[model samples]
Target: MSVSTLVPAAWWARLGQARRRTFLGYLFLSPWLVGLLAFTLFPILAVFGLGFMEYGIFGRPTWVGLENYRDILTNDRLFLTTLGNTLYFVALSVPLSTVIGFLLAVALNTRLIGQTLFRTAFYVPSIVPQVAAVLLFVWLFHPQIGLINFALDLLGLEGPNWLGRPQWAKPAIVIMGLWGVGGGMIIYLAGLQSIPQHLYEAAEIDGATEMRRFLMITIPLMTPTLFYNLIIGIIGSFQVFVTAYVATQGGPLNSTLFYVLYLYRYGFEEFRLGYASALAWILFLLVLALTVVVFRSSSSWVYYESGGER
Candidate 1:
């Protein structure tokens, strides 16, 4: 009674409500903050610091100034080759995923029999373990006895040697990557569902054709989702490693040598930790620049229902 009554009523109320909520909020967020500090933020800062030094895992890091960046930009032919390959992959895969995912989402949104079954069937491939998926695709794309070539044979056509040929290797990887388009399709489906149905109904009342309704109403409204997926797809495409690592090993003359795989080779395999850190920083900057450009351009197209601007 003495201690509680000594506190002002207004201050007690503030402590009971606002301070309690603030404490609870921080308490709930503590784990994530701890993880960010211990793992993410520390590693990122360490990598950035290491980029300026000559460090191997076994020894202490020595300061080397901008030599790593200079060598990567000017002297490293493989770096340029990998960067180009990464850009090529991003250019093809991102758009293909976006278009295919949008189409699949649109199809799923229709009133069709067994729609739920179809959605499940499409999404299941995305959840398959990466190693298993790569192995399955290797068998499927096998030049001799695979199902894909068998189908081509049945249709009186020759199947290209996918992983064995330089020109076809990256495309084979792209095809493998597309198997996970179902994940993007699910996101697009969510966006499609969130769109107001009344807009479509109004368009129907205005005598708009199906195609017109889709073009004028659906596409514009889905731009935010499209933008989000595009950025993610771009980043994923640049970091492509698994398929090439497991199936192709960036082989058939390094046709599928993606940026992250190249970085991994230097960091872990070749033991050039400092150079690898530089590569990582370069990749980060490239992604950041691309993201910034996309965000800047979003004002032209992307629309939000609430704020009316991206």
Candidate 2:
């Protein structure tokens, strides 16, 4: 057949430039696409598959179907305990972090002497290496010689064993988590700075009290940032491991046994790869569900200048 018989010359000529551009775009994106598939997508799929099997480090993977999940749900008391501990940590840490971060941002937004220094001081702790911070806290939390106990003694009050007592272990972790609130504070400060100054001026002209303006204008506009911090806090709090692993190692009657720490013990220490994969999948679903719920609720609470509620 003639070269031009199957397709019209005009149509082929018109398609050539668009096709080349598309190919070039994809060619540039190929590296990222390959990396995503190789490192991210493949591992996720492999883990999901492994979740259905029984693969200890020493043996071949055997198809166990739902056995891992059944055991976790029915037989594993530690699973429930870890899950409850994680929820407790998340519940306490997220709200406290959000509120404290937001307040710090608000306070920092105002003009003050040495404002930059104060902001930097508040934020520096958030950038410290997690292990280092945990180790430092381990000293500060010592029952007898720690700085915290020394301060309590100065106040003529006794300090309980912070990390040694099961009742205080989780709260100690929560207090440690607060040390990183400066990251969220930065986000909140950015949100606060982004709010139009004219709105506050107008509110003031309308005889709105400082509290009223803050309640109506500041909070409503900052809800999006609040929602963002809430989601991040929940996700991060659920996966708390390094602090517990380094400081407590789920110690003092397993009070600090968080979900990810438990998963790490199974996957690495215990060499139960398949069971660990199942645990990972469950955590993924739990975080996903919570994220979805937050997103759903956001429309009611999160305000945007363009759309009001979104």
Candidate 3:
């Protein structure tokens, strides 16, 4: 049968153009689709299945049902310990970094001498390689003959062993984490610059003080940036591994045993692939839940100029 006899001429003409564009689009996207399936999606599905089995590096996978998860929930002492450590790190580091980064951004936004130089100096630490930065801090946190302790001694005070004592180990890591706040600072600076200058001028003309202008105009406008930095900081802090791994190796009575480091021990060091997969899934759920909560709460605080309370 002829094609014109089977279909309407107008519909056939439209189909030809639409089909060509669709085909071209998918053809160009084929490489990315293939890579996603091969690399990202495949591993996630494999890990999800492995979490239910008794798999390891050398042996065939044995289906054990929920045994891996049951053990992790009930019999795993290190699981709770590492979870607590990670939460503690996040609680301390996220707020400190957000506040400090915002303040630095505000200060640097002013027209001051050597302003560019100061900004560069503060940001340099964030760009330094993670391992190298941690290694540098290890020396700085030394109990004896370290620059920090030397400065404290000059002020007629004793500096506690930062990375040595259990009480101080997590705090040391928190302080180390603060060194990279410059990344957040840059984001804040951009937000600050984008705020309209006329609003500040009107407030000044209306007899508003510096503090009032800051509280009324600056803070409300900056909330979106603050919210962004807060979310990123929380997620990054939860995944803290390289610093603790290189600096303390989850030492000082396991005070620095972050969740990712614990997962790494099981997956790579001990070769308990199934157990590690379970742990990985748990971590994924924890982070996902926290992120959802933060996003839900953000509508109350985060402000957007185009659409308020977005």
Top-scoring candidate (lDDT): 2
lDDT string for model 2 (1-310, tens) is 6435655777656777778568557767999999999999999999999999999889699999999999999999999999999999999999998989999999999988998999999999999999999999889989999998899999998988999999999999999989999999999999999999999999999999999999999999898888887887888888999999999999989999999999999999999999999999999999999999999998888888876633
Q: What lDDT is obtained when candidate 1 is compared to the true structure?
A: 0.90
Candidate achieving the largest TM-score: 2
lDDT of each: 0.90, 0.92, 0.91
What is the TM-score (0 to 1) of candidate 1? 0.92
- Per-residue CA lDDT of model 1 for 1-310, tens digit only, reads 4434655667656686677678667867999999999999998999898899998878889999999999999999999889988998888899998999899999999998999999998999999999899999999999999898899999999999989998898888899989989999999999999989999999999999999999999999999999999888877787889888999888888898999999999999999899999999999999999999998999889988778733
The better candidate by TM-score, 1 or 2, is 2
Error of 1 at 229 (Å): 1.1
Q: Tens-digit lDDT track for model 3 on 1-310?
A: 6555655778767776678578657867999999999999998888889999887899799999999999999999999999999999999999999989999999999998999999998899999999999999999999998888899999999998999999999999998889999988999999999999999999999999999999999999998888877777888889999999999999989999999999999999999999999999888889989999999998887777778733
Give candidate 2 misplaced runs (Cα > 4 Å): 1-15, 308-310
After superposition of all CA atoms, the RMSD between model 1 and the true structure is: 3.8
Clashing pairs in 3: none
**Per-candidate total of colliding backbone pairs:** 0, 0, 0
Shift in Å, residue 50, candidate 2: 0.8
Rate residue 175 of model 1 by lDDT.
91
Candidate 1 regions off by >4 Å? 1-20
